[model samples]
Target: MQINLKYFASVREALGGGETVSLPAGVATVGAVRAWLIARGEPWASALSEGRALRMACNQRMCEAEAPVSAGDEVAFFPPVTGG
Candidate 1:
């Protein structure tokens, strides 16, 4: 399946901005995607670490790790907000 992926803030810097990529089916959870991304090596591993402050959105709405993903969905990743 293919999904639109967006990276923001520090994550964008870490990931060198963004691109759309194809993800395998059954990677239904945010955690699953994170794990897959980390397996890509280097910056992905560091950028996606659980210890890092991160936030996600699915189809533009804030989402949790357990949020379900579908083919053609848009998923976004970014550092946690610091501004008030």
Candidate 2:
């Protein structure tokens, strides 16, 4: 399955705009995508680190790591927004 990943705001600045990843089966969740990216090391690891404050969306809808994903799905990652 192929998934499209999008990065926004700080996330985009760290990882660039986006990329497409081809999954080799057994990896089928939003979290899996994140884990895969994190495994890429360096900027990926630091940008999407587990301790980072980030928000995710699947197919343009806000979703959690456990959310199910499939081929052609678009997953987006962005840092939480806060303004006063």
Candidate 3:
């Protein structure tokens, strides 16, 4: 399955900004995707560590790491919002 991943703020900085990646079909949750990304080495590892305070959105709606993912979904990752 292919997913469009958008990274923002601190997450973007850590990942050198956003990118799209093709994932295997069994990567069905946000947590699984994060784990797959971390396997890519430095940038991914630091950006998606378990201690990071990250937020996510699926198809434009806020979601948790346990949220389900499907083919062609758009998932976004970012730090906690600070603006008013």
Candidate 4:
């Protein structure tokens, strides 16, 4: 299924904005999508690593790793924003 991805802030800097990706079956959750991208190795693995502290959203609403995702849904990733 194809999902639209959006990267923000530092994540955007590393990944260059966002793109659409056709993921293999069994990737039904946001975490799975991140895993799939990490499987690509290098930049992906490092940028979205399992240990990394980050934020995610689905269709513009904040969500956790367990958030369900479907074809055509938009998923976003980025480092947590901090303000003084």
Best by lDDT: 4
Q: Rate the local accuracy (lDDT) of all candidates.
A: 0.84, 0.93, 0.85, 0.94
TM-score of each: 0.89, 0.95, 0.88, 0.96
Residue 5's lDDT within candidate 2 is 93
lDDT string for model 1 (1-84, tens) is 887788898898888667777887768887788778888898889988878879999889999989987888888899878877
Number of residue pairs clashing in candidate 1, backbone atoms closer than 3 angstroms, sequence gap of 3 or more or interchain: 0
Instruction: Please write out the lDDT profile of model 3 over residues 16-41, one tens digit for every residue.
Output: 56677899767899888888888888
Q: What C-alpha RMSD separates each model from the true structure?
A: 1.4, 0.8, 1.6, 0.7
The better-scoring model by lDDT among 3 and 4 is: 4
Backbone N/Cα/C clashes per model: 0, 0, 0, 0
Q: lDDT by residue for model 2 over 1-84, one digit each (tens)? A: 999999999999988999998976788889888888898898999999999988999999999999999999999999999999
Candidate 1 local lDDT, residue 84: 75
Off by over 4 Å in 1: none
Give stretches of model 2 more than 4 Å off: none
Clashes of 3: 0
